[model samples]
Target: MCIIFLTSLLLSPARTHNLEEIISDCGTKLQTFSIVQMNYDYMFVYVNGEKMGLLEDGRLALYQRFPVGSVLYDPCELPPREVPILTDAAEYGVTACKLIPYGHYEAYIPEPTTGDLHPMTGENVCVYVTNLPPNTTAEMLGRYFEAFDMVAEADVFTAPSGECTGRGWVVFQDPSKLLMVPPVLEFFPRLFIYTSLSDKIPTRTTLQLSSVPEILVPGTDIASFAEPALNHNRSGNHRRMNGKASGNFLKISNAANAGVINASAYYFVALIRRDEVEKSVEEGVFWTNPANRRAFYATLERGPVIIIFLLQEYPVIFGYARLLPDGNADKNGFSACTVEWMKHHVFLKEQDMRNIPSVPISKMGDGVPLKPEIGESICQLAEQHPSHSTILERLGQSSPNNGRHVGRGAGVVISGNGNLGGFNSVGGGGLVHSVGDRGTLRSGIGITSLPQPLGARPATRGGHIMNNRIPQRRRPYNDNSNTYVGYGGGGGSVPPRKL
Candidate 1:
């Protein structure tokens, strides 16, 4: 019973030899000694101050025999806690040795923090760092530096939240702390990894910043001196360049017969085509509202009726027509008002035009009331075909002035010899009444010969084009019994009597 007890006592871990003695006895095998620390299920190894790798499974079995050179860390050196053990001999296995004094295993003892100098000041800043590896605390930073020199202020922004994202800035009262920065980066969770050196260190120049400047005080009422002359010049230039006056062409006037009353000019006649002229005439008669037809005819100076078709809507059809009272010069009449194409083709959004308001017929005098003539039809047409109502309304609203648009001219009309192409006159005149597009002169006949206009230089090229919008106008000729009809307008001069 005594022998068994002695054997048991000898095998007990408490009876193990001292660390220094065990390390000395191992001799050459002691050089291979290493420490393994438990990190959850896996254990990490440290040898010669370098971390090796994780221990594989089946390497953690307890109570295994080892060879003479085998190595294992003493549990006494570690904090009182559960320590994982290796079992698989062929893998993690090592020879067992009696414990030795920690001092004898000099390589295993952590070296004092050395070679760490303030990166900026090159000062010995080692004593400024404390509680380094396992439980590094913010208070340690303050205490450690306090031993070296006076610290005006010490602020340790501990990552109280969690592990930092691997970046931090520490400002010391002495600025010497900048020297001790690790070449390797430190990590903390949930923060961005800083790469640029400027981001880590604050500069003296940046610390001296200034506030923004104040707003200036309001001055005079600059709007009072607004000049209308400038506005007029600008508006006139816009009218000349951007508006309807920009589109100009020559036209043909009456060339129907030898002695027919033809008076349209030559330059005007040479531009337009005979087919367009014919279509305009036909649509003018056919599409004229019956109610306004007679009054329109009576207002003509010498012709039966002034057939004006709104060419804006293609397939030029007669639009809502109104009579021109002999003495009515005021813009109270629709003919006196000019059409202003919007800068953008936006839908009309005015209030009065929105509702189905009543318009009196008596307001029209002898001609049909402009509103009654097209209002109901327009509304009904819009209801059925919303896509085309505005176009129709714009067409109905258009009217011809002498030869120009009511407010905008630079356009002309010809009727006497409306010959745009037919060789009736030296310049051009024909048998149709036609008005040209803006910046042009027109007459209904056929382009006979193009004559240079007054103050107008001859075009470098020939072939006078009649309509500005439809740049192309070439059609096969038919008989004059069927008058060629063309409908076009611009604000300018009047054409001859008839086509």
Candidate 2:
């Protein structure tokens, strides 16, 4: 009877306990378990018939369910573990592996046939050409790739001394064209091409503007607002069609004039300093005077504002943004509006502003249309000026090809004294001349001196002026007082002289 009772007790099932009870029993002396799989929000462990609980902080709890055929052991009972994954380079002959968070371990395995080790494919369609002739240059490579219409940029690697490194890269404007590049190009002598597609590209810094739906701001018509600014003759056909006006609202010209619209979009080109724009964008707050805000909204009727970066080289269209209606008065006594950045906006903050030039837009005439060619001109200017190259680099715009002159001789110089200075054959001359304190003087051609008094007649070549209208005033000499009279370009001032 005793043997039968012991057999029955041994065959009976073990009682299951909740996680709280298990934690009470184990106390702090619990063994950690490795997670094998997760099913129905429960973590399964490698130990047979055992499941683990998770804490609120995403950590595995000691509470576990142990069923039949399961075995639990302390840390000392486990076998020797393998070395942890290494992130950096290791010593020679040492086995090393990198642990990528949330990545599969098998992804690092090399392909048996190709021996390719990269885990992710590149996004750029750039190809690197190696083993090239020492004389191979970027221009030469660019010409060679001219056969491919999509070739956007080619850069040849050079040493610090500016010598060729026999290696270069070619980038395609369309990333899909990268697949067309062969594994090797044998067209050129001694040239071996290798796939070196980069997964990363330069971040775009230009602002993106989206048109706000007209329904958002009721009773305001963009077309009507633009009608006063449009040239009626140029937009006659656009007005005829639909009789109500349709087609692309922004485009000004069309070949047949059938789709042409005479409505010109009105925008307030606020001349915010680049530093101020950057700070506003960084802080996510844009401030303006209440009067300015009213003018901006009233003129465009809550339309999008075309923000331009007033750079020293040129005015660049940074991006487009709409001012939120919920403007509030800030501590600085200025009305503030929250700015929403468009996609792929450029960084505008904390940049060197000493080189930036401020624009006096108020002096400019109103209803001036923002020309598309202006943006193109700015882009061309950026390529020519080294100081403005950051704009192109940030925008990922390709630099102009070698040996191309970017309007170097096309600049005109006009002096404050109404003197026109012509550049030499290359248009590089400046319009500056030293002036005597008494009157205007002429130096060489296109060079004029300053300090011409108001209402004074023009001076002749011999420095004699014909002042026939006004009678000369005789003044008492003040030599003992050490006072002297000097003439400025606009007027005269009393200059103190040493006794």
Candidate 3:
């Protein structure tokens, strides 16, 4: 019996589920965190069962059933009575974990095992993945895919010349036989899953624009001063397919083709300083408080959100990012937001937000109460600035391969459209291999055979060619931003091929 007045959900959508592990002076424990979305206005919070917990790898672990219990606690009592801890397999989760003041109440939700989710199978089950991190390895990825299902085999993408490419495929085995879950990745990585099978799935390649209300010099309500009234549109046209929040979201892209982010996704302002934002970029992760989920994003729907970095003491807005919702939690359980920062640095100050709020707001997940409104203003300001990609555009940085260079040995087309775009080359086997782009790999001397171009029977290691053809590996979210897909073995690095 959980009677929850789900308020303040406009600026921040109510979390469908959550995961919380608290550590106190009494004893360390793993449990679902019970939280009430704070309402500055009238609020009612009653809980008698488990909470929807968060998955360690940025997905929600929704329980099949609701929480069940009537556990009462005595604040005067030093040691509270023990409650049954819940597992992912458990029908319900427990949110009645003990909390003590003087003791440290740290939060962490350990990553689940392969058995965490039910198994999936098919006749020729293959997964196509792209936008992998720089440090991605065959071994690490083998472990990562185990969460989805049984991996029959993990093969590195090798060019026709035998050089490994950045892109690879994981083949799932027959469900009848026992299979092992690949070990968990050493570090959590957020690579985009283009499709479950290597084959192409229908993707919507156009933007479905909608009008969001103006966040102007809007009036502030004194009665509801506890939380700023959010001003945005709810009449979005949404249709999801192939993991995309398709048909109804704002699809904005930049010239560099860096990456197209969803402008309409839930935006937020975190009370972080200039130094912290830079540190996160350097460390490649942004940490947020999970218990106070205004900051945690691991379980949020996968999409890009506008993020504004506000200084804690100063009214200064320092930086901004098109934060991808594929955020993860650290070993200690702090939520890490994956941010793709904008080049336009903000130095604006809002006088109204100079002083911190007096109301009892979440200090850890605390972004200012008027954060939603502030984010809207920042989005308008950012729209005036450049709109190129920060990370996704890096894929197209490779210099085009063209004439004048001669080679007697076999060449591997691992980058830059895989085009043997040269006519003056000494020997031409026409053996131009690439991860994507049907563009012919032209050559001079010996053009033995032209292997299949990308999007048309991609070559595999063990005589297994992939029919999982995507016309163009379009970003699952934005259909407009398409670049010739190529594999970079190590974050877009091209290696030498043998003669």
Candidate 4:
């Protein structure tokens, strides 16, 4: 009676199901690997060169056993395992294999093959593709269909408009037999289906050579369409189809004067000696550290700030008003704020100088005739400056409300009575000259000088001119003075002078 009870228990469906489950859980799916060893019934299987373990009949089963030198039948084949004494295959996959990755072994999916007429050769064979965007091009489509042996040429289309529609067509000489052509690109997330037979369009889609789709029809004919010129107009403003950024971003034309640096996009930063406000070199670079930022703000609290760069060449000068949050540059700063301030204030200032006459250097009313070429020269000077950071700092100081000026000025001279003028030039405009020493004279008489009239010769030294003192030539005119003259020509040389 005891023996009979044991037999009945082994035959129970639950016991059999449990045994199948153990066998399935012992191994993995797609066992394209080797069985290195076995621990009694549990077998150690190697797949894709990786080793793993599997079980059978509770813990008393081999995963899969194979005779040495036995060849794998399929690309997806696994190392053969010992067949269980049981005859049921369904129980192995359905019950036992459920616990394994991928459940049971499956075949490798190969690129599809197409079998149809070659439009050029009229040959009946499988079609293949080359040079594709991973899986995007039409050749890939044909390669995918070749597996079924019924696909013809795949002709893909691209709209010049770059629209999202999958408006292109794929032609098959005969697709009735070969179904399931892999999808080309799509209209949305899903693949587009080509179900029409009689409506195969003969439009010639331009081939990328690499991505070009094949059209396998009776004739090897192709057509071409002119792609529309790229519409750079992004604002939907057709009126501005060719209109460009006129102020800041436009590339300055050089077809006229070569070697001239246009200063349309440049800015200035001056480190003028605060005391010697007129001369630029006296103003050293604003060295910023945590400590300097504090000093800057402290000075700001007292009164308006002045930043300056004594530049020689750059024509257009731009300024950026950075509303720096206290400690912004000193702490973990977001560069986006810096960039935004640059785009708005500096860029707009450049535009103002370009369009509004009042915003230019002439606005100083030193009577200097502002020349467009001088602006270009200033731009060249800024570009030639030693460091980009130094230039940016100078640019920041020149921002509106900073109360800075960049042109040459009567910086401190030992002989304070030195005359200075004609610092700038514009074509066809009269020279702008600066008046000599004002306020009280060194003689302390407080006598004002005769204001020299325009186009008149410079006044003689110490000569009385119409009740005003003719100031003495305290120092001789030299190239270093603001009065240095330039003749615009190919040589582009400054005129000779002596101290």
Query: Model 3: per-residue lDDT, tens digit, 52-121?
Result: 2333221222222221222223233467443334454453443334333222111112223211222222
Of 1 and 2, the candidate ranking higher by lDDT:
2
List pairs with backbone clashes in candidate 2. Answer: 205-346, 207-319, 451-488, 451-489, 452-489
- What number of backbone clashes does candidate 1 have, counting pairs of residues 3 or more apart or in separate chains? 88
Lowest summed lDDT across 10 adjacent residues in model 4 is found at 208-217
Q: Write the per-residue lDDT of candidate 2 for residues 1-499, one digit (tens) a residue.
A: 4455444444557447554654454443322212222221342222111233333222322212211112122222246233232233332211233222221111122333234332211223356777666666554554344333223445566677666587776654334355555566643434355545553322211111111222112122223222212111111221111121211132221212123322223223333334455666665555544544444444343234432332222223443344444444454345455555331133232232223322122111111122222222222223233332134445343234321111211112222233332221111111221110111322433433322211223444444443433456665544444444342322244543435
Which stretches of model 2 miss by more than 4 angstroms?
1-264, 311-320, 329-333, 342-499
lDDT of 3 at 270: 55
What local lDDT score does residue 475 receive in model 4, on the 0 to 100 scale? 42
Cα shift from native, residue 215, model 4 (Å): 51
Arrange candidates by TM-score, descending.
3, 2, 4, 1
* TM-score, per-candidate, Cα-based: 0.15, 0.22, 0.24, 0.17
TM-score between candidate 2 and the true structure: 0.22
lDDT (CA) for every model shown?
0.25, 0.33, 0.33, 0.28
**For model 1, what is the error of residue 338's alpha carbon versus the real structure, in angstroms, after optimal superposition?**
13
- The per-prediction CA RMSD against the true structure, in angstroms, equals 38.7, 30.2, 29.9, 32.1
Candidate 4 Cα outliers beyond 4 Å, as residue runs: 1-269, 272-372, 381-417, 420-455, 462-499
Top TM-score hit: 3
